[model samples]
Target: MKRCAALCAGVGMLAVLAGCSGTPEETPVASSPSTIGTTSAPAPAASVPPAGPLGSAAYQAELTKLEQSLAGPLRTLTRVRTAEGLTEAMTTLADSLDAASSQLADLTVTRRLTAVHEVLQDSLGSAAETLSNSDRTEANARCGGVAYTSQKVQRQLRADLSGATVPLDRLGLKFGGTLPDPGPEPKPVRPSNGAIVIRSGPTGTGRLKITNGTANDVAVSIVTDGKPPAKPHVMMYIQAGKAATISRIGGAYHIYFKSGADWSPTRRQFGEDCSFQKFEQAFGRNESWQVNLEPTLGGNAKTTEVEAY
Candidate 1:
């Protein structure tokens, strides 16, 4: 109220100044409360930004419908007792999924929620495939596949919704609260013709993390030729897009990786004669190190330098 009064006072003073400057003749000033109507007019309103299509009543209603429709499908999916029953449940689920996807397909709101639709589609499609597996011998593979895809999708949905997600009251499945736990990552298959191992230098103590980015299997090992370390060197096998961590006793060391018939070595010996800054100098403690291997010429593997810490 005080601020509004001050603003009005400033406006009135400006008006009085303008009135005085207009003419040499004396002009009657409207200063009394009775003259308030002639003195000032209401201030114009501040403009508000539009909320866009996502904020539309129709879009929010669509979301509510989607959340509600999942109830019957969720109940069916969670109560399957046999493979045939599972198939029937998935048929219903797939239909619900199709309907949900279609609702958002052409809408501008779908752009931000693309991940939600992808998760729904993947879960439905994989569930159908999982239940269609007739080979008893491949039961584990079928179960594993479904578990992997569903777990990842559920986790993503949980993260996307955060904790305040609305729950499906009828189905008892809350978006963020009812997500399944993450399953262990599947092991990568090493091709028959995988990368071979090159000879490693002597080992030393430190932390060694190896990342294989090339399209081959890499056999990495830590070696120390300097001070007799407390921990022995360990060999790590990593596939493409995978990594392995090893503990090394602190000392000067070298890294070696082998791919195919070629044996390549890291150029620098870690923790060897080189010294760190006074503050960074190791105080009877092992410093952390990471080595990333990438494909070089013909078939050799070369280490890449990247800041990992």
Candidate 2:
């Protein structure tokens, strides 16, 4: 019963969820008895300069950019429940984390404020690695790792000289399941043929029912055309032999499911004619659908109409 409408809409406000050093200075080159006499100066104090810099105004600006980079990707990573969605979201998240972690290493700060930055660097990196490399069946179940890790970075926003507040409050970010948590891990659903995609958006509030019948897990991608510049709006995860609900959705859109790896060999898409606007108007208000993946004789997934409400 993990719900939807939380990805980019933001019922209230904000957003993921972090990152080098210079070589040691040559010991004040001993005069080797030659330069030592050059200056009537006391022998230069021998010391190794600190490796990294402390936080600064410039550092704060860099934090701001990292904050922005993390917002969309973190939200997507937390909300997306499908294998493909997880893969896509993690891919995006990893890119942002990679940027943050890499940049964090090179910044030359005074006093070396490494603790906070390292917390974020490790969290984002760990979360991204889990999503990117974990087995497909296990990826969605591991989303909790992404949530709490990013939340740690979120809590440090205002405290940091960056003083990141606006983004922190939005998305209603929190820990311990304040955000929707996927139910018990589901069994993999495998559609012998291919899965189905049904696009819908209820006028006010509506729920979407997606059922995956096969033994392998299926991931759903929903995109809306209600406004121009259509983008991926919501993503759902349906485990094998499991049914999940997208409790809230509003607008017009189409969806496509990544059945088993069978579709990996070729690309597939849904037509605009399938927009739920047609049905919402025809049926008036509340609209729901049952998307079932039926296997085909060939080693492929085929699209078919199930039922709509």
Query: What's the lDDT for candidate 1?
Result: 0.36
lDDT of 1 by residue, 1-309 (tens): 000111111211110000000113322221111111111212111122123334223344554555566566656655555444545555555455444444333334323333343344344334323333423312221222333333433344344434223322222223322233465433444432223222244444456555666565545544454422222144455665676666544454555343331211231111111111111111122545444454333321223332100
Per-candidate clashes come to: 12, 31
Q: Could you give me the TM-score of model 1 versus the true structure?
A: 0.26
Per-residue lDDT of 1-309 in model 2, one digit per residue for the tens? 222221111111111000000223222211111111111212111122224343344445556556665667667756654445655665665565555555444445533333344444444445445444545323322322333323323333223322223232232222112222344322323333223333344434544565565665555655565432123345554656787765455654555444333222112221111111111111112345444443423321223332211
Whole-model Cα lDDT of every candidate shown, in order: 0.36, 0.39
| TM-score, cand. 2 vs. native | 0.30
Give the Cα error of residue 2 in candidate 1, in Å: 99
Judged by whole-model lDDT over C-alpha atoms, candidate 2 comes out at 0.39
Best-matching candidate per TM-score: 2
